[model samples]
Target: MTTALLAIDVGGSTSRATLVDHAGNCLGQGRNRGGNPGSNPPDLANAAIVAAVEAAIADAALPGLTIELALLAMAGPKFKAVQDQLETALKALGLTGPVVFTGDLQAMVASVTAATNGYCIVCGTGAGAVRLRDNELDAVIDAAGWLLGDAGSGYWLGHQAARAVTADLEGRGEKTALTSAILGDMGIELNDDRLPDGRPVPYRHFVDTIYAMRPIELARFAPMVIANRTDPVAARLLAQAEDYLVQDFSMVFDRELAGPVVLGGGIVAHLSGLQSRISEIMRGAGQVPDIRLVQDGSVGAVVLALRSAKVTVDEAMVQSVITSIAAHGLRARA
Candidate 1:
C-alpha cells in the first residue's frame, strides 16, 4: 500500500486537486469550477472543493493508496471558519490524516521556489500583494476588492477601457481603436440607438449594457484591452496597470525591493507585454526583480503537503512534480 498526499488549490476561477507520492510523482489530478468562498457562496465553494478532491481520489485508481495528509490552499478569507466542516467532508471521502488550510497566495509562492520568505502578487479579476515571512503572511497591499482598490486587476483594465470608449463615443475623449473593438466584441452597434436629433449615440446603449451586469463581469473585457494594446487608449491603460502592479510590489516591501517575487493571476502571468514592462520598470528603480510566474497554486499546495508530511523537497523536487503532473496530463491553464 502506498501512502499518498492530497493537495488542493482553490481559486476564484477554478479548483484543482492532485495526488502525489513521496517521490513527487503525480498519481492523479482533478479540477472543478471556481471555489473561492469569498467570491462565491459557501455552499458552492464547499461543493467544488469536495468534488475536486473526490475526482482526484477516484482518478488515482490506486486500490490500496491511503491518503496520509490533505492540504488545501484556499482563496477565501474566512476559511478557518469552515475548516471543521471541510475536514468532516474530507473524512467522509476516506481521508484519515489531518486536513490543513492555508492561504491561496502561500501555495502560489511556494509553487516556484523553496524559499519561505518573499512576496506574492495576484492580478487576475482582482489585484493584491502580500509579504511572506517564514511561509506566513506578514503584510498585505491593495487586495481591497474592486470598489476600494485592485488597481491593476483585470476588472480595472476593463473598466478603464470601457470608460475610455464611452468618453470617445460621447466626444469627450480621444478617438481610439478601443471604441470599435469594444463595441464589436460586445455586439453593440453604433446605430443600436439614436438621439433626438437622429445622431448615432451608442453611448446610451453602451452605458446601459455595462450597468446591466455584475461589476465583476467587466473583467471579461480585459482580454479586449490586451488585444488592442497598440492602440493609444489601450496602451495608456496597460502602462498605468503596469505602474500600479510595480507600485504594489514596492508598497509591500516599503523598504528595499528585491526578489523571489512570485506573481500569479491572468494579467501578470499570461500577459508577456505587461511582464516585460514590469521588469523594465523594476530595473529602472534599481531593483533586480526575480519575478516567477505560476499559472495556479496546485503545485505549491503539493509542495506544502509534502513538507507537512516530513518529506524533504527542493527546487529540483518541485520541478519533478511539475514534470510528473504534466506527464499525467494535469497541466495548468495556459
Candidate 2:
C-alpha cells in the first residue's frame, strides 16, 4: 500500500489540507475557514482544522492507503496549546504517524526556497516579518494583532479606510472619494440627520454597523481599499500600508543573508502595486533582493512534510509537487 503524507496550512483567513504521496502526486485537497488559535476561539479553530482534514481524506477516496505522517504549518502563536486536540482528531481520521507543528513562517519560506537562511514577510489579515537561520525562525517583527500592531496588514488597511470615511463624514478631515465608496459598499445611504458639525452623514448607521462586527472582520474592506486606490484617501492609505510593510521587511533584513527573501499571504503576494513599491524601496537601499512569492503556506507544508519523512526533496521534487497541486486544482489563489 502506498503511504501518504498529510500537510496542512492554517491561517487567519483559511485552512487548507493536501494529501500527497512520496512520488509528489497530490491525491486530494480540502479547504475550510480560518483556524488560527491565537486569532480565533480555540474550539472554532480546532473545528476548522478537523473539517479541512476530513474533507481532504474524503476527497482522496483511497481508504486503503495509510497516512504516514502529518505536518501542520500554523499561523498565530497559540497553536501549540491545541496540538493534543488536533492530534487526537487527526488520529480519528486515520493519521497513523507522528504529527508535527511549526510556525507558519517556516512554511512560507520553504514554499518558495529550500535554502536554510532567508527572510519572510507575511501580509494577510495580519502583517509580520521574520528572519530564518538554518530553516528556523531567528527574529520577528510586528504580527501583533488587529488591535495591537499588525501594521500594513489587511485589517490595518480596512481600519484606515473606515477612519478616513468617518473623518470625512464628521467634517474633521479632508473630503475624499472614500466616504461615498465606503458607504455604498456597506449599503449605507446618507441619512437626513446632520451631525453637530452640520455635515449630512450616516453617523448612526455607519457606527452601528461597524460596532456590530468583530474588529478583525474589518479586513473585508482591504480589497475595497486596494480597488479604490485611485482615490486620494485610498491612495494615501495604500502608501502608508506599503511603507509599513517595507519597514517590517527592512527591520529583519540581513544584508549578509544569501538566500532568497520569501513573501507570502494575500496582500503582499497578490498586490502588484505593493510588490513593485517594495521592490523599488529595497533597490533604492542598494540591496538586490531576491524576492519570491508563495501565495499561501500550503506548498511549504508539503515541502516540510516530505523533508520530515527523510525524502530527498530537491527543486525537481518541489516543482513536481507544485505541478501536481495545480493539476489537482488545489492551488490556493495561485
Candidate 3:
C-alpha cells in the first residue's frame, strides 16, 4: 500500500526507471535500450519506452503498490510528442498518476549539482548546454543536430577521426596514429577512395567504431585537433567546440545570476581532461564559474522528483536511495 514515485531518464542510447518512496529510498528499478522519442520513429520509440517501464515495474516485484507520480526526463526537441507517447505507454501499463514530462537536460541539470539555479553542459551522442536560473530556463546553445553541430560529442569525435583519416590519405593533412587505428578497428583499407567495394561508409559506422573503442583510445586522437584549433583547415574545429560551451555559460552569467555550472552526459563524464581544458580557457575570458560533472543522471532525476514533491533530501535519505537502487542490481545489468 506504499505510494511510490517513479523517475525515468531516457537518453540517446538507454533508458532507466526507478521507484522510490516518500523517504527517497529507492524500492525498485529497471533499465533498457535508448528511447529518444524525438529521434526515433514514433511507434517504435513508444514501444521501446513501454517495454522498459513495464520491465522495471515487474522487476521491482511490487505487484499491488500504486504509483503516485511519474517524472520522465527524455532527450529530444519535441517535448509534447514525447509526453503524449509516454502517457499512452503509461496507460497501457495499467498504472496512472500525476506524470510530469520534461527535457532530459532538465533532469541532468538537477542531477549534477542538486541545484535549482545553475547550468548543465551535456555531451553524449550529441552535445549541448542548458541553464536554469531561479527554476526558470534561461539559456541553451549548440543543440543542433549531428550534421550542423554537436561538437565534442561521440558522433562528432568519431566523425572527425574518420575525416582526418581520409584527409591524410588524400594528402591534405598530417598523418596520425588515428588513421591506422581507425582502419584497423573498422577492418577497412585506408587507401580506398570509397568504403571497401566502392560503397560509401555509413556515418553511423564511424560513430559506433569510436564509441566501441576504449576511452583512452578515443582520447588519444581527440587532442590532435586541439593543436590545429586556429587553422581553418583545423583551427576552429576543436577549440570552437569548447568555445561554444564557454559561450553558453557566458550567456547564463550575463543574466547576472549566481550559480555554478553543472556538466553532464557520457562524453563529459568520461573526458574530464577535456572539460578541464575548456574550463581553463573559459577562465581566461573572465567570469570563471564552478563546474561539476554528473555521471549518472538518473540519480539527479530521483533527487529532483523528491524535492519537487516536498520531500527532505538529507544525507541519510541519499544513502537509503543509493542502497535501494544498488539492491535492485540494475545499473550494471543495463
Candidate 4:
C-alpha cells in the first residue's frame, strides 16, 4: 500500500488533480472543467472538483493507496462552505488526509520559483499580483476582481475592447482590429444594428448584449487583441497592461527590487511575444528578478504537501517533479 500525495489546482476554466509518491514520482493525473467559485457557480465548481479528483483516483487504480496529504489551490468566497464541500468530495474519493487550502496565486508562485521571498503576477481570466515571504502571502494588489481593478487582466482587455469598439461605432474612438474581431467572435453581423425595417440599433444595444455574457465568455475576446498586437489600439492596450503590471510589482517591492519573480497564468506563460516585451521592459527599467514560468502548478501542491508532511525537499527534488510533469504533459494521464 503506497501512500500518495494529492495536489489540486483549481482555476477559472478547469481543475486538475495529480497523484505522486514519496520519491516525487508521478502516479496519475486527471482534469475537468473550471472549479474555482470566483469564476463558476458553487454547484458547478464543486462538481468539476469532484469529477477531476475522481478521475485522478481512478487513474491511480491502487485500491490500497492512501492520500497522506493534500493541498488545494483555490479562489472563491464563502470559503467555509467551499471547504466543507471539498472535504466531502475528498472523502468520497477515499482521500481522508488533512487538506490545506490556499489562494491560487500563492500556489502559483510556489510552483515555479525556488525562493521564499519574491512576487507573483497572474494574468488569467482575471489578473492580480501578490508578494510572498517564506512561501506565504505578504502583500496583494489588484485582485479586486473584474468589476473594480485587475487592471492588466484578460477581463480588463476584453471589456476594454468591447467599450472601444462600441465607441468607434459611435464615432467616439479610433478604429481598431478589435471591431471586426469582436463582432466576428460573437457571431454578430457588422450590420447587426440595422434591422430589415432600416432602423439601426443603438450602440448601447451592442454593449448591453455583450455585457449579458459571462466573465469567462467575455475573456475570450482578449486574445484577439493579442493577435492584432501590431495594431495601434491593441499595442497601446498591451502597453497599458504591461505598465500596469510593472507598476503593481514596483509597489510591492523595494527601491532595490531584486528577488525571484514567478510569472504564471495565460498571458505570461503562453504569449512569447508579450513575454519578451514584458521582459524587455523590465530589463530596461532595471528591476529584473529571477523570472521563471510554472511547468505545472500541480507540482506546487505536491511540493507544498511534501513540506507539510515534514519531508526535507531541496531545489533538486522540486525541479525534478516539475521536469517529470512537463515531460508527461500537464495531465499525466497514466
lDDT of 1 by residue, 110-224 (tens): 8888887788888887788888887678888887767778898888998898889888887778998988888998888865567896545688778889999667678888888
The number of the candidate with the highest lDDT is 2
lDDT against the true structure, each candidate: 0.80, 0.82, 0.64, 0.75
Give the lDDT of residue 132 in candidate 1: 85
Off by over 4 Å in 1: 1-3, 64-66, 79-85, 166-174, 195-212, 254-259, 269-289, 330-334
Residues 1-334 of candidate 4: C-alpha lDDT, one tens digit per residue? 7788888888777699888888777787789998877767778888998888888888778878788877888753435787788887787676767888877777777687556777777877767778887667888887666666778788778778887888776767998888888777766666646656544454555677786877756667789988988889988887888777777766675434456677777765544444565465457668663677775667777777677777777778888888776765655433
**TM-score against truth, every candidate:** 0.81, 0.89, 0.74, 0.86
**Positional deviation of residue 27's Cα in model 3 after best superposition, in angstroms:** 1.8
157-182: candidate 3 lDDT, tens digit per residue: 65676677666655567666665565
Please report, as a residue range, the 10-residue window in candidate 2 with the lowest summed lDDT: 269-278
Better of 1 and 4 by TM-score: 4
In candidate 2 the C-alpha lDDT for residue 19 amounts to 94
User: How many steric overlaps does candidate 2 have?
Assistant: 0
Better of 2 and 3 by lDDT: 2
RMSD of 1: 3.8
TM-score leader: 2
Cα lDDT, model 2, residue 130 = 91
Global fold similarity of model 3 (TM-score): 0.74
Candidate structures ordered by lDDT, highest first: 2, 1, 4, 3
